[model samples]
Target: MGKKNVSGWSTIIMLLTAAALFTGCSASAGSKPSAELHEKTMHWDKMPEMTIDLDKSYTAKFTTSMGDFTVKLYAEDSPITVNNFVFLAKQGFYDGLTFHRIMETFMIQGGDPKGNGTGTPGYSIPDELDTELKYEPGIVAMANTGKPNSGGSQFFISTGKDSENLNQMPNYTIFGKVTEGMDTVLAIAKTPVKETKPIEPVIIEKVVIVQS
Candidate 1:
């Protein structure tokens, strides 16, 4: 995928660089996040059914090499996006994935099974932007190909600094916000990168969905 800057850019996916072509190893520290790496070839022919109860609150606990963070999903505001995210989390689709694109001031993006920006879950979902969502720090949203209804498996978290710039590009669908571990999110944002890809891999060990 191609990449573009914040100014005069139409799509966030366009900011993808050649660094996405290579997968880096996690920095030396703790044990692997999972016992086995999740399969990458897993694909769906269509969007998942809405199985989650909208009356209940949903949160996703993300365990990564940098640390852990919890995102409260907006099921009522963005049901389709939340449903797909929860479905993938339950299916272990985000295990052993890397944050392929990390811009310190912009956002950190991952959930691409291919460890690159071009991979997807063999499906797509429509954009859900009718809420009072903003691209502020800790807000999580879906990344797309700058086309309507083009979002799939890739997602991003607003780190800080340049997050406000994202407001100008409102096509990405907002699904959740970080309720805990903002420090971890900020730390992950600072991971050394060559261009936009992390020089040392920041692995997303797993993503667990919790409901109440």
Candidate 2:
């Protein structure tokens, strides 16, 4: 995948960079917030379905017919977002999850409890589209409608080089990059989709955060 779509770590890095500047520093938990993360994670928002993990190198295990894959997260960059994900991963919020939306040459979207692609974790965060990160393949990014800062859990990965039109608006936080099983992601991306959307939903067996 040459990365024709922009959604992944590229977006989050940019957001975090800008957030740092705006907040007078990076988004750090003040004096260690609640570790009472979620024991189970529901769809996006709605409290992450688990407790928050402020700092840590987390891994998410994704099991699919294509195979099982893992991804690590950077809490330092986006604490609340990362914690929510981590909480959900631990709770297996994504266990029965499906890649609801798969647009060929664009991106694959998932993480909505509604499963139809529209759902939130209850609250939305401010926009964090920092320029430090650029749209690149294998990068993980959040999904949102025309609304800015409306990204919840609904996220996508760039199978190929996404257009810079994403830069048109400073939104959608990209947080992590798939370090392994990239071929698996590519294989999923190669699947046939109706009207450029996946005809068969790519379900996520579970999301387990990996430690490296």
Model 2 spans with C-alpha error above 4 angstroms:
1-55, 163-165
Please list the residue runs of candidate 1 whose C-alpha ends up more than 4 Å from where it truly belongs after superposition. 1-39
- For each candidate, what is the lDDT? 0.79, 0.58
Residue-level lDDT tens digits of model 1 in 76-182: 99999999999999999998888988988778889877665666777789989877777889999888766678788889888875666556546678999999999
Model 2 residue 126 lDDT score? 49
Q: Over the stretch 1-212, how does candidate 2's per-residue lDDT look in tens digits?
A: 13345468777644533231111112221222235211223334345433444544666667786786666565656565666666656766666766766654555666755455445555555455653666567767666654666555667776765423455343567677778888888888788877544677677777767654
User: Each candidate: how many clashes?
Assistant: 6, 35
TM-score of each: 0.82, 0.70
